[model samples]
Target chain A: MKKVAIGIDIGGTNSAIGIVDEVGTVLTRGNIPTDRHSDINLYIDDLAAEIERIIASTDVELDIQGIGLGAPNGNYYNGTIEFAPNLRWKGVVELTKLLSERFNYPVIKLTNDANAAALGESIYGCAKGLKNYIMITLGTGLGSGVVINGDLVYGHDGFAGELGHVCVENGGRECGCGRLGCLETYCSATGLVRTAYELLGKSNKPSVLREVVNTEKLTSKLIYKYAIEGDALANECFRFTAEKLGKALADFTTFSSPEAFILFGGLANAGDLLIKPTKEYMEANMLEIFKNKVAIKPSELPGADAAVLGASSLVWKELSK
Target chain B: MKKVAIGIDIGGTNSAIGIVDEVGTVLTRGNIPTDRHSDINLYIDDLAAEIERIIASTDVELDIQGIGLGAPNGNYYNGTIEFAPNLRWKGVVELTKLLSERFNYPVIKLTNDANAAALGESIYGCAKGLKNYIMITLGTGLGSGVVINGDLVYGHDGFAGELGHVCVENGGRECGCGRLGCLETYCSATGLVRTAYELLGKSNKPSVLREVVNTEKLTSKLIYKYAIEGDALANECFRFTAEKLGKALADFTTFSSPEAFILFGGLANAGDLLIKPTKEYMEANMLEIFKNKVAIKPSELPGADAAVLGASSLVWKELSK
Candidate 1:
């Protein structure tokens, strides 16, 4: 029988699972909608039932090695999810303990979704063979996983890599975390819309963005399309975003001298529109020692399966150890 | 026969060597005036001769396990000193190689004095058993060594913990590194004097510090004395230093969430006068998760001997490994 480990990526709207082999090949997988139920136990039971149903019908004779879970507010050290704002659950939820009780496995593990994505990148994606790098996930909110000396920096309480919450503009935008001027507020998909609105107020540029702005239908994808079609205002919006991102990257490099910063998620697809300006400004603002080094590249993992691969990589990593 | 290691702390003005045991007991030690000879070879020869002379008549039948060297630009990776600005040496000088050739036994390692001090603190001083923390040495310049996951964070290159060079105030103070507003320029002994001078221009408060308007005559120790004696201007100068230092510390905590920040060097001796206000500001500025949890305390190492114990700890650590 082929040895396999289950990887679960828990999102706000959906959950993904995969049985993966040692070389990052997903042998089998399935997905389930994240129920709106507020009770923590019911959600875990549903997830457990779904996982069992998926693997039971698979043709491949498999030995379930372990389970790795990636979610918001997941603590790698404590094996619990504590006060995840998006998940209406209050206080500490021992997801790992609940899962292990259902699956009789000795190797259950967990990490924040961002860290899992970084592990996936490190093990199977763009950052292969690179020991020092950061993985930035540009989704609804900006998330980062810091890798230094080939290990996740868990700090004293496993809450170290809160890169999104770090202040970029000193006293600029208000964040959901209640902190003002957080980097996430100026660099996420939401931040892009905020930037487009700010630019719309300042500029008299003739563009399709004006129509989108009037309807309040401004999305990062629409902005990318306009910029690619030679809209000056749209192009300027990306430049503005990159400028903040580049300066933040330059500041981050001072702390951990990584060889590269691998970007993942929706906003990362803007590609050269965002990357070129980020690279230019990163170089411009970096200290002398870090000059001409540190590559800013995109994730190599398939976008659709990145979270699953990342979640799987966590179990793969643990089993290997 | 007892096992021992010779720890060398090489400074610009003087060099100190001590024979230290595993438990941090300094059996015997000696200091020699550092010769600023143009020829680098003569400097090495003199250092080795001094070490040999110190151990010549000792009654303890000892096996010199290894030699650990702590210098200005010491690279732990290559065991070389590379263009330390304070030192006249131009190119990469493999001091460990030179020492090993003379001693016939393996001279284990080298690291910058600050890193060595951090290692020393972790192994024998206040930071013993604490995996995550940062040690700040405030002398002629501010220096830092970061510890994450129970080891020194060397980064991609050996030059990771250059916290002094990290820009705190954009276009604020002129740094010796030719960078604008580096943390060191506002937090070191020199920074304290600069703070006092700046205060002298702004405040007309009656204080003894006004007697030294020239930067040459002003020192951190003198300002510390005045602050202790209730000079409002001097107390304000310390508060200014603490605020900058505190903000920087809060920013750094985002990267590596250490349990505490251990402070060392001349100005740290001011105790509560400096630490209290720094602690207050650092807690005030820190993220909600980190507030009031992190301790900012003075280093427990014995004065100048910290570098020696720290250097020795390197060899001892390697041998234990």
Candidate 2:
């Protein structure tokens, strides 16, 4: 019989479940649409049913050791999911209790998606054997997970490592978190598009972006494409984004002093276009004590497998601990 | 018979040695001038002699279990003091090995003066029972120590928590570390004097400060005195320092999510004059998730004893671990 644990990555829109072994290999996986009902209990019930069905269909005889979950606003200390902004859940939800009752084994753990991804990197990706590192996810909004002293820096309230919200430029841009000049407001995918629009207003650089602007459609992918084709405005947007990201990272280095920083998610796919400038500026701005010592690299994990492996590996890692 | 450890805090000018018990009590203490000899071995010989003399003079019947030394550039992992600018020592000095040879017992220890103070706070002072907090020392230079997950955040190569070097303003002020606009260049006692001189250049509103334009004549204590007498420029200097400090702290909160921040050193004696503005601005600038949640407070330990207690506490804490 194979020993495995069930890993669940619960997003605001969808949920994914996978059977993962000790070495972080996924055997089988399934997904379900997240119901946005006011009652969180109903949502948990629906998720439990879907998980039971997936387990019943799998032919491999497996001893399911536990379950690990990753969700927005998930508290590792309390095993509860607090009021996640993107989700319809109003108050705190005791997820571990409900899931453990259904599984009949330990519903082992919970952490925010960013921390989960960081754990995945530490356990099975580029950050292997590294005691100190920061995992940055540049998606809809920037998110980060900090590792210090060979363990996750959970802080006093399990809310540490909120690096995206750190104010980089004072009074520069408005953020979804209702803050002024947060790092995410100027560095994420949306931030890149916003920069492209600002560049358009400043200079009349005749380029392919002008056509996209006329259609009222602009995305980071579109901007990246135009920049690669030698569009001046689009290239400037990437340079501006990398500048802000590098300076902010230099400041963060003073606090945690990680060995390296691993970039993940959609925007990170831009590769050297983003990494080169960021590395240049970060090294230029970093303290002399930290200069030429820290490494800045992209995520090595496969994207589709990252979230599931990260969420599931939390159970395996915790159980072994 | 009781068991004890000898804790040594080596500074640029002087060094403090104490025999500490498990309950954070300094049974006996001694001080000696830091001899800056060209040979590293000579300095170690002097240090060992001082320890032997202090031990022989004490009548207390206690078994010395180990020794802990805190220096300027102490590396906990390598057990060596790296190139410390203030000290005459260059390159790596293996003080741990020398101390162990003299005592004939394992000298289990590590970290610098700033981190030692943080350990002291965690084990004996206001941060007792707390897992995450930052300790800032406002002496000749600004020093910081970060605690995450109940341990000192020593990043790769043991050089984490250089908060003083984090940039507060771009191209604002030149720092000793060859960085532009570092936080310590604007927040420490020396920084306060520099700010007063800069304010003198920018503003006409002044009282007694005009007479003292040179930094050699100006002191942080004198600046506080003038500010107490309602000098607008002097008060503005403190406010400016506090604002920069508070904003920087808000940035740190995003990474560490600490319970509280403890301030130590001579400048911390400014009390509410410094604490009030820092608390106000820090709260005002923090993210909604952290608003009014973390405390900005003063250190409870006395200045003279805090470093010694902190250095000693490192042994007890590490032994317990």
* lDDT for position B248 in model 1: 81
Docking class of 1: medium
Q: Pick the candidate with the highest TM-score.
A: 2
Q: Write the per-residue lDDT of candidate 2 for residues A170-279, one digit (tens) a residue.
A: 77789998878889998999999999989888987787898888996899999999889989889999999999999888888988788899999888989988989999
Write model 1 residue lDDT over A137-184, tens digit each, in one string: 888889889999788787898878878877665567888877667778
lDDT (CA) for every model shown?
0.84, 0.85
Candidate 1: the clashing residue pairs are none
How much is the lDDT of residue A242 in candidate 2?
Answer: 96
Please list the residue runs of candidate 2 whose C-alpha ends up more than 4 Å from where it truly belongs after superposition.
B24-27, B212-216
What is residue B250's positional error in candidate 1, in angstroms?
A: 2.2
- Candidate 1: where are CA atoms >4 Å away? A201-211, B32-35, B202-208, B214-216
Against the true structure, candidate 1 reaches a TM-score of 0.94
Instruction: For candidate 2, give the docking quality class from DockQ.
Output: medium
